[model samples]
Target: MKKGIVQVLCGEGRGKSACALGLAVKAAGSNKNIVVIQFLKGKNEETEIGRRLEPEIKVFSFEKSERPYCELSDEEKQEEAVNMRNGVNFAKKVLSTRDCDVLILDEILGLLDYGIIEPSDIQKLMEARDEDVDIIMTGIVFPEELNGCVDKISRIDTVDIKGV
Candidate 1:
């Protein structure tokens, strides 16, 4: 099996998640198994790509509350933290098992930024990932610690088109 490298996608652009989803579709088209773990997003099957790609692609979300992290009460924050921790554990298990060819950690950077998960947690996930499983992470800012570890880092910037 060919070795798969880690890829990070981040920036102020609007299509980070969309790009990840597109890749999931492409991978599915090639019969590659995919697992997407979304952070900070509530469960909504109607808008979920994983739901549409069921049986081929699996998605798990760590969102326990619909409220924004910044606006959450201390108690709610604590609860969300637990859910995020569980999500991290699940991700570690998936990576270790190597059950899928592709793994997408959607909005994981936001989790780090919001203190939902620690930077060390991400490091652990990267270290535990199987050699054959490609990993994709999408968020607004790339973690500095992962700069040297990831194989490719793509930053998307929005272009203002006043009139099109």
Candidate 2:
């Protein structure tokens, strides 16, 4: 059996999500099973890439509303916390199933940013994943605790473009 390694794409660039999506497409094209769990995106606001890969790729979201975290009220934040917890549980289930060849945790670092989930929680998930399931995490800030846990880490720096 082949072993699947963990890959992290993090930093302040615009292509983090795009990179993950591209990987998903490529994996699907190769007949590999892929699952994507988005931590901060809402159902209505999910990117078209997810929609386009439907059936071939499974996409799940934890967001309860379209409002950004900065704009959410205390009550909304509380509700979001529940949703985030659910997302964590869902991820655990998926990882344990070993049904997917690739598992993409999209913007999962945002949960750490909001203090909704701890680094230890992520560490536990990483430890529990199937040996053959490739885990890809994309976020702006990578947790220091996960420094040596992943096999590959790619930092994306934004390059300013004058005009499109």
Candidate 3:
């Protein structure tokens, strides 16, 4: 049997989520089911397009505030912690259930940055996935702790900004 592929798109640049979404689209093109769970960053221009993907690509977010998590007050951050955990649990569910062939945990590595979850949690989730599925995670930070667990890591480094 083919083994599952665990990939991470991480760095201090833009387009990590965009690359994950591209992977989802490629999988869906092959009639594969996809589930995307977003964290930290709240909404963007692409959210509506993702929603339109529908049953083929189910997108979910557990963030309560409309604003990005980074912009929220401490009080709001405390409140959002629960929701983010729920998102993590749901990711585990998706893996255990084999609900989708492609699982995109957008900005999930940021969970580690905020002390929301541990590397062991991610290790466990990776272990629980079906051998045939593919998992893709994106974040601004590359998780050194997961270097051994992840099959591949692509660094997105920004060279320059288009505008000042």
Candidate 4:
């Protein structure tokens, strides 16, 4: 059987994006095409990590601003939401092409929390996914109904962060 999509919803501590990046690196080592779209976090080290790969993984970020040091204003929040929606749409287009072997949708849960991407839209995308591509989606507060369709579901619990 073909390896299936891996949905990792890590709400707690660390290693969410790290895990995804690790998978991407492994896939790239085997010469698989990889695409990563980070909804919340972007342009950090992980984004850079993919760049050094021989084939150079394609990395896209819909987040326009650097990580906020303080709480965001309503306008900034709206802007971020717009970026997230664009990211989702871009992912949809990429998926529609069905070209790559692995596609990563990072921090999509946060987008949903901020009321950016809707679960229903994601449901539609999953319904339409190409069986050949392996997908990894990281998010929080997973919708109650995504029970059977997802091949793997992992919920990372919260852990306290130290000395931020």
Candidate 5:
């Protein structure tokens, strides 16, 4: 069977990365090469999962701050942009090899949301890849331009418990 295009998991609720990681696991089990680029900090669960995963999984982080776990400095922001570009570049290289069946740009939308990376660059990255390689994009926010490029989009809305 041929692979699917891009699937964007976005919104305010949690589990975006979790859902993406799950898909990666399934793909890896099927002997499909997979790469996951995480932008957010402290994805210990994912790291642990990747370690236990057989056939090995390509996962890496480009986090700015180890403390506060929420804020990012200007330098961190710059580093993130570089790392984001590098990840996409690496994916492009991998796509040329025709080895990988899936590539997950985890938290990519968040990078775009924070203006760490350009939307045009992302569009180009999608265009440069093989049509059969499946992509699972996870982030809290989705830009309008990106929304148009994606094949399917699923949003997770949040529920407020206490009304202050």
Candidate 6:
């Protein structure tokens, strides 16, 4: 049985999401479907660049506030938790339905770090996808518990916060 490669791009680096989006663009150029579900980030405003992706690469962010999930007040965090879970449910739906050729769960690692979801959720998410559907996850921290399940793990730690 064949299965799609699961890749994780993680660490304190800045380009993780960019790398995922670049891959999505490549997939889109090849006439393939791509879906991006962004978490942790709370940017409610959609940029012009994001809008340009169009029906080719669908980007979804369920966050309400412009503040990061970690920055929210206790009450706000509670509210965003529900929204984030909805995003996870939507991701599961996309995977089960084979709605896209590539699924990019941006900042999903942070979801684990924040306890919004468990390794079991990730395991289940992985199980839910079709064999040929690639999954790319980007975040600052990659949980060690999932090390063996994924096909590839790219640690994207930054060398320096200041330019050399």
lDDT of 1 by residue, 1-164 (tens): 79998999999998988899899889999999999888766655523646777888898887667665567788988888788788889999998988789999988899888887778888899999888789999999987887876899999999889864
lDDT of 5 by residue, 107-133 (tens): 777767667678886787788778888
Candidate 2 lDDT: 0.85
Give the 10-residue window scoring lowest on summed lDDT in candidate 4.
63-72
Candidate numbers sorted by TM-score from highest down: 3, 6, 2, 1, 4, 5
Query: What is the C-alpha lDDT profile of model 6 across 1-164, one tens digit per residue?
Result: 44679999988878998899999999899898889999988875542366579799999888888898878899999999899999999999999988999999999989888899998999999989888899999988888889876999998866864776
Worst 10 residues of 2 by lDDT: 40-49
Model 4: CA > 4 A from native: 1-3, 42-46, 68-70, 158-164
- Model 1: how far is 115 from its true place, Å? 1.5
Please provide, for model 2 over 10-36, each residue's C-alpha lDDT reduced to its tens digit, 9 standing for 90 to 100.
999888988998899998998998989
Where is model 6 more than 4 Å wrong at Cα? 1-3, 44-48, 161-163
Q: List the candidates' TM-scores in order.
A: 0.91, 0.91, 0.93, 0.84, 0.81, 0.92
Q: Which lDDT value does model 6 have at 19?
A: 91
Error of 1 at 102 (Å): 0.4
Residue 82 displacement in candidate 2 (angstroms): 1.3
Question: Each model's number of backbone clashes?
Answer: 0, 0, 0, 1, 0, 0
**CA error at residue 137 for candidate 3, angstroms:** 0.6
The lDDT per prediction is 0.84, 0.85, 0.88, 0.73, 0.74, 0.88
* Cα error of candidate 6 at position 75, Å: 0.3
In model 1, where do residues sit more than 4 Å from their true spots?
Answer: 45-49
Error of 4 at 151 (Å): 0.9
